[model samples]
Target: MSHQAIYRKFRPKIFDDVLGQEHVTKTLKNQILSDNIAHAYLFSGIRGTGKTSTAKIFARAVNCTNSHDGNPCNECEICKSILDETNMDVIEMDAASNNGVEDIRELRDKVKFLPVKSKYKVYIIDEVHMLSKGAFNALLKTLEEPPEHLLFILATTEPQKIPATILSRCQRFDLKRIKSSVIVENMEKICQEINVKYDEKALKLIAANSEGAMRDALSILDRCVSFNNEEVDYETVINLLGTVNYQVVMEAASSLMDKSIEKTMILVDDILNSGKELSFFLDELIICFRNMLIIKTTNSTDNLMRVSEDEAEALKNASSKISVDEIVNYIEDLSTAQLECKRSLNPRVLLETKLIKMLHGVNHTDIETLTKRIEELENIIKSGNVPVARQSAKAAPSRQTAVHNDFPAQETRKTVVSEHAVKQETSHDTSNSVQEPRNFENKSDEAIFNAIINGWQAILKKVRSENAGLQAIIRESKLTEVVNKKAVFEFDPKFTFHINAANQPKNRQKFKDVISSFVNDNCEVEFISKREKEEKSNKPKQTIEDIYEDLKNEFGEEIVEFKQED
Candidate 1:
């Protein structure tokens, strides 16, 4: 006897044995029971989710003479022959290797012959998407209109590559990824049956790392079993797979949240020195943050599975120190780090830099929040809104008031803000430069042009604070001129559509309000294309009487006056 892998040894023998695909399996079982099975079936899903296994079991069940309740008894002769791969009626083909037109033509020739012994001839083609276009054309007619005793089961991980012509002719059954908890439970059952000693947490780590594939889980279990012959523990699993344990994830998260970079670096060094892959480490970090976020945001844990009680408790205790928004920000930051670390030359330094940024509180929302905080502080300081010193009036009879008592009374304004907000504001150099308001109504045209040009970045920020979506549209636009107190905006020829959109009444009003804050008066604005502005530059200016004649043409004679009153 030869040694067999755990996955192959425990291959599913029937539709009921397949895990994580009850939606597909149940439907096939009902079809079999009702004698309404289709001639052609297509099974598609991620790899190792039991497409091939289901096809094999369905083949056996359809040919079993003594099938019970749509399940092959496995005791009958026909089921035994099919299970042992000795049945002539059930033929399995690998479409990856046999994808040429000649191979498909030979298959077409074989389809004409009826089954020798079984009730039907079942052809199972795996990786069916690998079939060439010509091969697909050859099999199209047969797949669409096969003989009464023929059944074709096509399986592929990628169904998008298959032609829609063939896709529409078959009964397609989509499969889903197995849940981690389900994979864990199934592995536990297998471990008990094999009489192998294992830790519960160890199995969970395997399930999580398996990525929703039970076959992958079994393969990992086989490796663990080989590494530690009789007993598999938590240490064995992580060491073998180069994965971080839940303890490391919790401790690292705690160190980062507490801004203890030295301790976090030491932990990183320890993991890397132990040969753990940096990619997997980052993935574990993301999962840790996600789990903590779930516990903080949700009221129940029914939907969350595969998390241990101790881990959940640790996450809860850590959740109190950080906010839900902060946790979400952390997850997003780590998600980007995961991608960056993969492409970076030195992932260790990159990850360390990200940790430093996390300590400083970095994200999109931090910018706008910091701006508001600065405005609040500026108001408080200018108004002397602080706590005043206490004065003693009845202590002694003094000829003059004390220095503390002689000062003007200060009003207190309560402001609650984190130090991270201050740091975020301080990081941007322009946030500290508050421009003085200017009255542009009496100012010269050159002065207004300099104001709009010099203060453009500030105006952009203010507009961003109003609606963030406007920033993308107004990115490359500049103030080219100031004409008759109406600010003229010149946009590129490519931005013709944005010109009209930004000049809408509501958006134009919002722009005017932001500009009014700087100029101290209502600022009317007009957006024009570069070509239109150039064409207008080539034309001559009209006189006041010319503008009057145009007004009189619309409003009649009383509104128009060609001569002066003198």
Candidate 2:
């Protein structure tokens, strides 16, 4: 005889043999022991969860002539016949192939016949959800009230597709996904029975890859055995499955946390070049982050299923370097990427894009990002890196002018931020530059623009408190310039609605009022896209030196110093 597949060779023949479905098995066995049998039974669960196997076991147990504690005696003639597929009374059908109304009608017609050998004629239909609507209608009446000598067993991975009328007529049993621990134990028994050498960790890896499917686990084990016919080692399973190693995931995660884009991208390319599927590697990364989050929050690895103690410790060590909020954000972004990865033709590109975004911390407008930005500013201030400007009695009264004055007095009045913030205040073209005379009441465009950029968040918060819709419209807009008492906000060209909505009389007035209060100037608000800003200013952009000269003219050389951090 040809060698049989491991899954088929080790198929469960009795209730005791089916693993990880004790709930369904115990209930069915009790029904059999008490001589209480339902006409129709429905077993539903994910694939390889023993739905069809349980259906077959229940069918044989109900008809066994020599039953022991609600289990079929395999030695009995009837049980043997059914097990060998030689019993005419126990008919098995694949509803996926025979899903027409005519197929169900034939079964309805056959229900009237008496059993050929067994006490009851049992009909087992697998993938029963594949049946058509008309086929369901055809089977509804007979399933609702079958003949006393007949029984119906239906199994499906997807029970939702089955009609309600058919579902209500049968006793339903939901099988659960088998646990990895149970699967590993079963594989160990199989290996011991077959006299095959194996590593325990290899079995664990197989079980994890199977994703709670017993058949999948067995199939993977069969391949590994065929590959070596000796010891099934952890490395062999990893290579066969083309799964990313846990260490590789840890390294990539560390690179990301360190904000090392080059290292992360190189690691990604290496994984793909080594023939690992991008989706699988992506799934591993998501799981890795999720595990870290679990360990970080719960302070225990008890909830983790597949991670060993050593791996759990490594994860705990890694989790210490990142915050819980960062872990949550990574999980969310990676999960979204996973969904897109499925449909994407270039999954590698998609994966890299998500990784870059995560490394850069680019998710914007959310409360978490806002809070992170605030914390960073606070940290900079706490470190005493921020410069505080002082004023003397000889200084200008305007707060904006007082910021640039280099006074000997110890009285500090304004914060003169570093060049990083000042550089963000770009220099406009001299052709378009407003020639308004500088006064104590009106601030220089440089001061006003810097104030707008620095205080932008506070302005948004004020607007949010009064009108959230206005805040949302301006959320993506950058306050690029404050010229001629008109503040210009540049948004991405794709957000056309922002420009339209922000220009509305009520919204414009409300937003202008908030900005006026923020910068203490009655400035008019204007919204434009970056593309429009580019088009309006056709002159060559100013160089760094040109910007420096402009700042030097506005503020004295003492306050206009440039310091670059390494």
Candidate 3:
């Protein structure tokens, strides 16, 4: 006999043999036992989740002559014929290849007749979503009112593409992706049955790489076995999949956590030299980081990493050195780099640049350190110990009362300003006459706007130095004005790229923070086109309570719980 792939060879012949789909199996079994079978059934989920296998098993179980407990007896003639694909009543069609209206019409015409021999005439259509619109319309009426003896089972990975009319007629059962732990357990059982020497770590690597697909995991295991001649090890599996070594990923993460760019780059270089794909390495790193995050945040191991207990403990230990925010940032960067690597002509260059950025990005600044520094500055400012030169100078009388002359209650404002100026100037000997008059006339608007423009220019320079594409777009952007604590930025129609970039929540928040720090105030920043009107009515005007409620809904209800802050 020719060699058969593991996935095909080990296809579930009975519902009990299906792994990681107990919900599906149990429900189908009860339906069969209670004689509540639907005329048309639709099975949907991610690929390799046993949608087709379950359909076949259902066909056999319903038609088997000598069936017990909702399971088919493989020894029966009907079961054997279906298994061999020679059953006259059970017809399997690939809708992907035969998707015309005529084909569906033919099936619809045939459904009016009774089964030739079996108890039920089963039509299994794989990838049913590929059927044409006319074909779907043709199938709709027949599927809704098929004969008592006729049954239809539609399977598709992309069920969303299927029209709602057809979907409403059939009973839908969404099969879930098989979990990694289930995949690992099943692989171990298969290895024991085949008498192959395999390590648990090798099984783990296969499961993780499978991405919750049982068939893919088994197929990978089949290749590993073929290469090693029945003795599968972790190194052999890694090499066969062209995956980065787990140790290498760990070392890279450790170096990043330690802020050792040199060590991380060396590890990256070694992986590249070995000809492993940078995209694949990034995917593996994401999984590694995900595992670390799970360990750090959750005390339970229910959905934790599907590795061995020892490996899980090791990940737990490693996760202790990094904060949750750092992990989130690292994953975000790697995920973005992975997406970019897919489109770049030189993936290696993109990968290297991203690694360098991850190792040295300003986002990596420790939050605890920043908070401590801010607290120290606040303490110094509170204690009246700041340098005398850093204090503000007094405002001149002309600039102070100029605005009041146009109104009437100007003396009161001037008196208040003079008192503040006296107190502020008493603490410092800085030049009060130089810029104080101009600032008093404008009341700090010009200074704030200049500071905002300077800060944005600096950020643009940094972005340009790192990413040329971003630089090309932001170069044409301009800062228009800062009014009512809102920084209004403008970009030309020729350079509309920053509009999309600024709309991203992360980028928007970063820009807002930078502008706020530059202006030295709790100001909001908004990016708008030059032609856009700054209508107060059109603004996103909302009370603080309303904003808090919206944020609570976005983040989670727990974020808004009342708490007394010290």
Candidate 4:
């Protein structure tokens, strides 16, 4: 006899043999026991989940002359006929190939005829979603009210594509993807039965790569066995799948956490030179990061992190060195790279680029990254090393502020000034801008403005929770200055819609309420155009040391301290 693939050779002949789908099989057996079988059935799930196998078994069970516990006795003539494909009563059709209106019409005409040898004729249509609209419509009448001697079993990976009219007339059963542990156990049994030497870890690696598909797992196992029929081990499986081992994965993750760019790149180079696929390695990297995150968050490995004790310990140690936020960002970057890797011709470069980015630094624009930076600054302040600017005679002095005589009071105004229009609108000399006059000498006002600037991200987060639309609009506006009880926001002239949106009566009030809660004062909000802001740009830019000194002054010595070296 010719060699048959393991998936086909070890195909489940009975419902009891189907793995990880007890909820479906048990109900089916009960239906058989009660003799309450439906005329039409719909089986749906991902591939290799045993939809067609279950359909075939159920068809045989209902026709078997000698049956036990809702199972078919293959010894019986009718059962053997169906198994051998000689029986005309049980017809299996691949709807993917025969999905035309005429095909369903042919089947509809056949439903009226009685079974040749069996009690009922069963029609199993796999990939039923591939049927055309006209084909589905043609199948509807026959499916809805088929002859008592006819049975229709429809299977599809996507049930949503099936017409509701066709779905309503059938008994639907959604099969689940088989678990990895179950696949491993079954594969181990196959190895023993075939007298092949194997490593338990090798079976697990295969199972993990199979992604909860029994047929995929078996197919992978077949290739591994073919490569070395005498034995299957971790090294063989890893090489066959083009994926790195757990040790390499852990080491790569460690290098990333340590920010050792050279070491990580060398590892990537070595893996590439060894003919390992970058995409598979990327997948391993993602799983490795996910496991570490799980360990970091839950502090437990039971049923979560699918690794050995040593691997779990390594993950725990590595996870300790990184924060949850950083790990999440790394996962996000790697996941995005993974998606792009499929389309890129040079996946190696893409993979290396993402790894380098994760190592270099976090995106400062991200809210979590900004929050982390603020926390780091606070820690520096508490440590008493806040920098102080050195005074030099030649250095420019702080500019003065001349109050605007026409400043509006108690009401918010939108200033849509252009470069040419600024002179006419301000109506005052701007060598010393008027916007800063109210807070120029009052250190308390300066402190309040600084405090709001530092807590800007938090305010945005609060606004996001309450009103996402408002937060989105105002996020583009910079809090340039806070004078009196009013807060001024500067928006890019192109984003004038943002200014207009924030100026609305209801949105403006909601934003005012949020800002008031943050500053512990009833604050009025104002939006200004970028052109108007530029007109008041006479303030001296602060040096790095000067900014640190301001932070120290605002947070106090206990929270922010700085030192200067001569």
Candidate 3: deviation at residue 422, Å? Answer: 14
What does each candidate score in C-alpha RMSD? 20.6, 15.5, 14.2, 16.4
TM-score of each: 0.65, 0.68, 0.69, 0.68
**Candidate 4 stretches greater than 4 Å from native:** 1-4, 299-310, 364-566
**Which of 1 and 3 is the better model by lDDT?**
1
Judge candidate 3 at residue 32 and give its lDDT: 85
Candidate 2 lDDT over 402-491, as tens digits, reads 444545342243223333322222322222323344333566555677788898788889999999988999998988766545688988
Superior candidate under TM-score, 1 versus 4: 4
Model 1, stretches more than 4 Å misplaced? 1-4, 299-302, 362-364, 367-566
Q: All candidates' lDDT scores?
A: 0.75, 0.78, 0.73, 0.76
The lDDT, on a scale of 0 to 1, for candidate 2 is 0.78
Clashing pairs in 1: none
Please name the candidate that would achieve the greatest TM-score relative to the true structure. 3
- Model 3 over residues 149-263: C-alpha lDDT tens digits? 9889999999999998888888899999888889998998888878899998889889988878898898898888888866889999989999987778787778878867788
Q: Which candidate is the best by lDDT?
A: 2
Q: State residue 182's C-alpha deviation in candidate 2, in Å.
A: 0.6
Between prediction 1 and prediction 2, which has the larger TM-score? Answer: 2
